[model samples]
Target: MRVLLVGAGGREHALAWKIAQSPLCEHLWIVPGNPGTATLGTNVDLAADDAAGIVGLATREQIDLVVVGPEAPLVEGLGEVCEAVDLAMFGPSSEAAQLEGSKAFAKMIMLEAGVPTAAAHTFDDPAAAIAFVEADQQAWVVKADGLAAGKGVIVPDDGNVAATISAIHELAATNAGTRLVLEEKLTGPEVSLLALCDGERAIPLIAAQDHKRIGDNDTGGNTGGMGSYAPAPILPYAEAQALVDVIFTPVLRTMAARQIPYRGVLYAGLMLTPNGVKVIEFNARFGDPETQALLPLLKSDLLELLHKVATSNLADVTIEWHDGAAVCVVLSAAGYPAKPRTGDVITGLDRLPSDVLSFQAGTATNAQGQLVTAGGRVLGITAVAPTLREARDKAYAATELVEFAGKYQRSDIAARGLAE
Candidate 1:
């Protein structure tokens, strides 16, 4: 099957690497892919959000399947664009994508579906948000209603409601007209579960734990993702299935009932709170660094699974995974999650182990034809092994091989899982 994969990030590179290995894939193309993806397939010079342009290319090329990798385009109606041409595409429609596009909308869905989540209130006025925070003594979470590239949610270090309000103000400065969602913060370990859906049926992938903070021991600011480890033993397969039964299934049914049947990945960011598994957020597409960590353990043909989901034949599909753990440590530019400095030359990629896969996120070929930094989160060093400890060790070791000026990575990825 000829495929056109969208986006240019570590997730796309991982998807490109995985899809290119499938024998069913006759040809692979990526829209505005990074340097790493360019090595895997034909990279088109088209922006991911250019809906008309993407559709024209897909139709003209007669692409068998268009696999969307980013949430931006998916939220902008890439699935509907494909539908217009009667082309097969793997992603949720724009209406269904509101689950990620708007936190308030997702909260409403959760409330309607009886999905367990934190109680929250949305505010368009900053003063009202601050007043709400001041009135509540409980620890709170302040989130930008719109996309902030994973840096929207702010949890204060002291868990002070006032501090959270301050964070909202800080976040709102650059994100003009920002709407805020303030919720009572829940305490727990978090897990990311990505499920493949075909309007009705859903197949869950192995649970992954993502380190959203930029520093070790979950300190510092939130980034796209600093690192991640898959098959989170904390949320085992049986428990994951229980989550699917109570959470994902109901949510899917609710969406179907609303006339927006979800078609692609349903990423549930869950918190294993004292009560039970409560949803942290919902993403219409695959989680980024989590995808880098989890895809390596996927033993089944990704192409076939994606096709099944897109074609609404997922009920008959059975997915398989390799028995092992996978880890990914993201190397980001200095001052990342803010104003990241780019254009530094990168080196040592050749030194990576055969088992390790270095997926590029923010990198480009400069006029000098040198691979250099082009974004905040640059490289994802991923490794899979028989044990989580081994996988974590290999991933960190691979990070040492890759060198660039001002490159930084979390010192402890999968540390909790390894300690366990």
Candidate 2:
């Protein structure tokens, strides 16, 4: 079957790798794909959100299936257009994508479904938000209602409360009318649990931990993702299953009960606290750096799984993962998440260890074809091995070999997971 995959990040690259492994797949095409995806199939010069163009390509190429890798296109109603054209799309419609597009909508769904989550209030006025924060619920999390490339959520330190509040106000001012969701910060270790949903059933994937902080020891501002590792050591077998029970099932059921009947990946970001696992947020597709880690561990044919899910035959499908550890270390251009520097020549990639796999996030070849620094989170160095220690070793070793002007990465990725 011919497939059209969307997005241009490490997540899309990982998805392409998995999909390409399927024996049933005859051809693959990635729209606005990155350098990594160029390995799988023909890369098309099409924007993920250009719905009409995508539909036109699907029609022109007679692509059998459309798999969307990012949330933006889904939020923009790509699935709706695909359905209109009778195209089998592996993404939710815009209405269904409200699960991730609008935090307020997701909270309402959880409230109606009795799903566990942190206490939060949706705000439109800047003064009102400041007053609420000053009133003090101890500690709080301020989030931009719309997608801010994962940097929307702010976790303020004791001395930086005023600055954090100012940042929140700045975001609100930039996107006025777009409300902000403020939550009384839930204390715990945050984890990412993703599932493949087919409206009626959802099959869980390996659990992962994403280190969002730019600095070591989980301090500093957030970027898209600093690093990630899968099958979180902190959550034991029983604990992991319990998390699914509390966070995934109810939420999926709620989406279905509302008649949305969600399809494609359902990502639940959870805060595993003393009480239990409380949902931090949800994504309608695979988490970026988490995908970098989880995809390598998947033993099942990704194409088969996605096809069955879109066709609503998930009862016959099972997601299998290798018994091991997979880790992804993100390499970013200097000054990421604020002012990123680009156009620097990259080096040392040829010297990377053979065992390590690199996932492209932000990159574009210069006129001379030298690998150049391009985006905030530039590339992902991923490695899988018999143990987390081994994987970490290989990843760091490969990272050492890869160098570019102003390249920066977190040295202590998966430290918490390893410590436990």
Candidate 3:
């Protein structure tokens, strides 16, 4: 077992390349990992929110499983400091990561677990959120009730209500003590759906589709993700099991009746609207370039489904996939998401193509070593096929054998599931 995997990006290098191809992950580690998870193992310079140097490096390296690939060290409590040293952590629990560290406490637990979302208002006074975005005449969505990584959500185009009230005073001048959820802009297509919880049964995975702007028909701004794809040929598997029965089983039965039982990787930033799957945020973990386009279409055994959701046994696991597509394609660096321009060097990551993999995410190396460009949605190529236009043509032909000095990507990644 011996896993560790906290974070460094490209969804922790695609969960350290599918947990080093599991056979029960004999050994693997990564904390401040990068350089594509230092080739799938020991990266450990420690600091995925350092909670006492990650429980003293998982009790001095005997770590049987930690796996918290981001969401600012599980919203800063680092899974209650690795379950207070009984350690075998995975993610949730800083009070179930406030369902992704507070979007007005996940719209007040999706309005007390009825679940379908959107139609909000939280504020914390930037002049009462610019007087409710100047008496909203629609097109709102201003977000930033905490975490601003996925560019803190904005959405202000059609008749730009004065740039959504000047982006709610520029995210209230850089989140001076956060608060401001304001929804009402929910229209169509957006689906991430992670799941895999053990807080008391939850499974759904495979339904990706991220493409968070940054140019190419969807237009600019919004980084963290620049491409993605998976079973989302427009959210099907019976509409992803009706978004796991109206959103992950009433938010895992209201976090197991509020004893705060949500364990890990919930995700679900859906929005299939026409009045159907309406949530647009909630990411307790796993969702970068949609976990590198759903872990190469995960055919199961991602370290035995995350050690059965960190030992809760995940109510009889049955997580399998790999039928058709997968596609990743992120690359970016040229001043991405405003001000990104790291070390540079990079180049054709060993000329990819054995079904293209990459991963990295803002790499590093230099000092005469090479492989540069450190952060700003840096690497990620992924491919996997069977269709979806041959995994978006082998992920844009391994994004043209990589490169650097201002790279950038998105030549229509999975072009609307290859034009349906």
Best by TM-score: 1
Q: What number of clashing residue pairs does each candidate have, in the order they appear?
A: 0, 0, 2
**What CA RMSD would candidate 2 show?**
1.7
What is the model-wide C-alpha lDDT for candidate 3?
A: 0.82
For 41-122, candidate 3 gives per-residue lDDT tens digits of 8897877899889789789978888888888778878778777778888778787887777788888998899887888888
Error of 2 at 245 (Å): 3.3
**Residue 311 C-alpha lDDT in model 1:** 94
Clashing pairs in 1: none
> How much does candidate 2 score in TM-score?
0.96
Per-residue CA lDDT of candidate 1, range 255-325, in tens? Answer: 99989999999999999899988998999998999999888999999999999989999876778999999
Q: What is the C-alpha local distance difference test score of candidate 1? A: 0.90
Report how far residue 419 has shifted in candidate 3, in Å: 9.6
Q: How are the candidates ranked when ordered by TM-score, highest leading?
A: 1, 2, 3
Summarize candidate 2's per-residue lDDT along 274-309 as a digit string, tens digits: 988788888999998999999899998889889887
Give the range of the ten consecutive residues with the poorest summed lDDT in model 3: 172-181
- TM-scores across all candidates? 0.97, 0.96, 0.33
Q: What is each predicted model's overall lDDT from 0 to 1?
A: 0.90, 0.85, 0.82
lDDT of 2: 0.85
Top candidate, metric lDDT? 1
